[model samples]
Target: MTLRRLMTACVIAAGIAGSASMVASPARAQSAMEAEIIGFHQLCEKGDRKACIRFGILIGRNEQRNADWRRAHADWFWFER
Candidate 1:
């Protein structure tokens, strides 16, 4: 594959790796998925720019979810009043 195509595939795979834990059922399944994510994350740490960018996107997504949940729960208090 060309460089552009390779980067796109790696980015897509990184996203899937990020979400793998969410849908994983068994402990073994989760372990395997987590290992895949770790591998990607390690690549990011090693200065692979594309991998680093994808990893940052994954982390940002998690933070966004946490912020959304916190906002929703905080709003619950107002709803009760």
Candidate 2:
């Protein structure tokens, strides 16, 4: 194969190898969910629907089920958006 083709193949292989080694642990997932909730709350304070829905989903089964679901439905306008 040509040098250019070999380099392209190497780059692709490297990218796949790098991504394969990348794993999101449960701890990382929890942390990300926490951050997302915080950011979503902030956005809700400023009135953002999509973020609110995400926030609700992240927290609905937590200590604020009713409230979160309410906001989620309201945010996305479960009846009408």
Candidate 3:
């Protein structure tokens, strides 16, 4: 993707991640989803190699109740192993 597209996707991912966790009450499942998404986005943007794997693991383990954070990012291979 172009830099503009990557940046735009980054911004959207941030919004999705933030919106999930900003809920006032932990009683809400959506809050957990939001928080996880936000965290995954954070780790991905920060280039946490483990977070990419972990994010997928989260979705696989938690299901929709926690949001599908795996789809939020594509692997950027050039800088990675």
Candidate 4:
């Protein structure tokens, strides 16, 4: 009975940890993507044409319905040429 209780506790702990990690995963990915986008924007500002294009493409692909997205769209169009 004691061993069974221990096993059940371990399973519950594992499940909680797994679910917590799953919840955090998307936030981490989004932050990472935002960091990449910021890096690309910085590079573009410093006259890296390739970075400008890449930044534009990344922002365009995301397609956020926000001012930032609109600004990025303009930047992309300006740098696309």
TM-score of each: 0.34, 0.36, 0.36, 0.45
Give the Å error, residue 74, model 2. 20
Off by over 4 Å in 1: 1-33, 64-81
RMSD of each: 19.9, 11.6, 18.5, 7.2
Candidates sorted by lDDT, descending order?
4, 2, 3, 1
Q: List the residue pairs that clash in candidate 2.
A: none
lDDT of 1: 0.64
User: Between candidates 1 and 2, which one is better according to lDDT?
Assistant: 2
Expressed as tens digits, the lDDT of each residue in 1-81 for candidate 2 is: 699999999999999888877753333443666567778988986889988887767776576755654675576435644
Q: lDDT per prediction?
A: 0.64, 0.71, 0.66, 0.77
Expressed as tens digits, the lDDT of each residue in 1-81 for candidate 4 is 999999999999999999999887774344677788879988998999999988867876755633465665576456445
Where does candidate 4 stray beyond 4 Å? 1-30, 65-68, 71-81
lDDT of 2 at 14: 97
Question: Which candidate comes out best when scored by TM-score?
Answer: 4
Winner by lDDT = 4
Q: Write the per-residue lDDT of candidate 3 for residues 6-34, one digit (tens) a residue.
A: 99999999998898887744763557766
Model 4, position 2, has a per-residue lDDT of 100
Clash totals, every prediction: 0, 0, 2, 0
Q: Which of the two candidates, 1 or 4, achieves a greater TM-score against the reference?
A: 4
The C-alpha local distance difference test score for the whole of candidate 4 amounts to 0.77
